[model samples]
Target: MNGAQSLIKTLANCGVDMCFANPGTSEMHFVAALDSVPEMRAVLCLFEGVVTGAADGYGRVAGKPAATLLHLGPGLANGLANLHNARRANTPIVNIVGDHATYHLQYDALLTSDIVGFARPVSAWICESKSAQTVAGDAARAVQAARSAPGGVATLILPADTAWNEAERPAQMLRDIGPAPVSSQAVDDIARLLGNGKKTTFLLRGSALHGAGLEAAGRVQAKTGARLLCDTFAPHSEVGAGRVPVERIPYFAEQIVDFLKGIEQIVLVGAKPPVSFFAYPGKPSWCAPQDCQFSHLAHPHEDAAGALAALADALNAPAQSSIRVPLQLGGLPKGPLNAMSAGQIIAELTPDDAIFAEEAATSGMPLLVTLSTARPHTHLPLTGGSIGQGLPLAVGAALAAPERKVICPHGDGGAAYTMQALWSMAREELDITVVIYANRSYAILNIELQRVGATGAGAKALSMLDLHNPEMNWVKIAEGLGVEASRATTCEEFASQYAAAMQQKGPRLIEVMI
Candidate 1:
């Protein structure tokens, strides 16, 4: 068997059956091997970012690693932004990055660059396969690294010669490595805090934000009267009307401080202590009150679900009554076709089971608040704080959960970054409803300029923020990308277009002229 064949077998044995790829010449052997392997499905992507982002979505839903096939350093570089998001989410991903043959390194070809340097920032574990005999074993190690604990990105760089060379035998498949136990001392401290009876919050994150861990948090909250909050930035949050309703900590520092003001203790479960996004003038980095005692009940790498279950059992916390209620959307203003404001459109456009991919920047804060009371849905925010991820994430999500309607309520500035994803949506006939908040400028940058105390900006400095010497023609762009497109100037048109897009089978775009 060839090294590439054995590597593919290793990946399949480790449960990574899906591969999202954007290949190059160096990866031809791997690609050929993938074609020969019947069980593995390789999804092609025009951009590396889409491949990585799709892998993130698959891992979040599939609860295992999805392999990514990227070219050399430049290809890996292209995918790094989404890898950042995946790492932040703790989504398991095995990356197979192709490299120059061992003998070709001294020649310093055009594609030759610091692939390992590029990978180290985003990957939790990285390895370079030296020979064909070791390539399959290296791939197996990559899968294990990705599957470790709460999950993370693992990269295996394979030289062209290594992939093409012959392997004597296939690598041994590895067994499941269970999560590390929560610290006994940490659990004891949390027990003491609960016994004290002061207002405490057990903030959830990582896998603890889903399924049984959520239920355990609900039970604990019901018994102790402590509020339950999710992490400020989560990889994937499993929230709905019927599930234990978890309030996420606000992104704004002052808002988080206000939220945590009365709480004397904060116990973490697969979450870190809340902190400010940036250190503003005279503001603290950490959001908790002066006397708030911080403790970790379980680390991110621990078995968060098991730990929470154990805590619930030890305390004998009763199942929450609120956990089994039907979903309800509160009364929202409608009917008048006034200014097609963000608030009005949000209330009118939201559906019962929509998956919201929001990278709406500043204009959507009001939308976020309003939609919190809207029907139950999976809300995916830009977790890594990167601007361009929303569009690609929306595409991947729509493809992954095809049965559920997907909504890409995107900020125009951020949407432009991965606007190419619209083409993929069109090609795949994904059920995606994209609403572009075309405010004609980088609205968030204006806010940042003010925050950093930069004042008296001239027309030239201000001009850089504007997207309109000629305003962006999003409808034109969408149509060019092979998706059905429309423009909306009024609330009625916005609502009509949004509803129409939701009902359609293929990808559709509505450019809301805000």
Candidate 2:
């Protein structure tokens, strides 16, 4: 067997079944070996960013790692933005980056560059397979690293010669490593703080913001009267009816400070101290008040659910119970569709168990408030603050949970970054409904321009933030990419098209003109 075949076998044996790839000539052997290994599913993407971003989505839903195949240094560089997002999300991903043949590196080939240098900033672990005999072992180790506590990004550089060379056998499958145990001392300390009369808030993220961890936090709040708030951008959160309701920290620093006005102590569970996404002219970077005390109950790598449950047990909290949100479908506006109307439409139409991937910069915030009382669903936000992850993430979520419907609401400017994901969704016949908020401008940048104290008196500075010089035709773009799409000018038109799209199968797009 060749090294590529052995590596594929090793990955499959280690429970990695999916690979998102955008390969070039250097990765031909690995590409050719895909036919030999029927267990590893190969998904082709047009851009490296989509390849990486899709893996991030799959990892968040699948609770494991998905491998990504990139061509070379330049190819790896193209995918770095999404990899940055993956790292911030703490999603497990194995990046298989192809490199030049071992012998060809001495000649200083045109495509040769520092692959490791580009990978270190985003990767938690990186290794290069020097020979055919070591490639399979390296692949196993890469999966092990990716599946470690809190999960991480692991990069494996494969030379062409090593991939094509003969290998004697595949490596042994590596067993999964569970998250680290929560510290009992930390749990006891948090319980003491709660027992005191001080007003405290629980800041949550990662696993603590969803599933059983959320229930534990709810119990603490029910018994102690403490508040619960999640990070501004969570990798994956359980939301909607019947789940514990947790508000997200506001994106703006001033709003966040106001939100935590009365809180005297903060107990962090798998969450970091709140910080502004960017510094403003006069505002402080830290969101909490200057006098607020901070306490760490559990780190990201620790078992957050267990830690919270222990704290609840110490406080004699009540048993878990259903928490319901009354569905309130606001009156739909009759005129042109704005953010409020768009949010209301989504709140009324979203199905139970749906997956919502959001990147609708400033316009999508209203949906967050509206959908809080909607049907039970999973909400995956842009964890790394990257612009182009929304569509690609929806593609991966649909692939991971085929039985559930997936919805993507994206800004017109951000959608342009990874619109290639729509083509993949069409090719795979994925069940995803994409809603484009076509405001014909980078609305977030306009907000930032004023926040950053930019004196924009000239037309040129304003033009840089506007997209109206030639407005994007999303319907045609979706049709060209093999997905059926329509344009909606008013709330009624948007509601009609959205209802029809949700009822149908496969990929569809609705461009909301606002």
TM-score leader: 2
> Which ten contiguous residues of candidate 2 have the minimum total lDDT?
320-329
Per-residue CA lDDT of model 1 for 106-195, tens digit only, reads: 899999999999999999999999999999889888998899887899999999999899987666667656588876666666777799
RMSD of each: 2.4, 1.1
Per-model TM-score, in order, reads 0.93, 0.98
lDDT of each: 0.81, 0.90
User: Against the correct fold, how does model 2 do in TM-score?
Assistant: 0.98
Say which candidate scores most in lDDT: 2
- Residue 65, model 2, lDDT: 92
Which sections of candidate 1 miss by over 4 Å?
A: 183-188, 321-352
lDDT of 2 by residue, 1-514 (tens): 9999988988998889999999999899999999988999999999999999999999999888999999999999999999999999999999999999999989989999999999999999999999989999999999999999789999999999989999978887787676788778888888888878998999998888778888898888888888888988988899888888788889998898898888899999889999999999999899898899999888888888889899889888998734445666675567779987998898888789999988888877898988888888899988888799999899888888999999999999999999999999999999999999999999998888989998844898889889986878999999999999999999999999999988999999999998
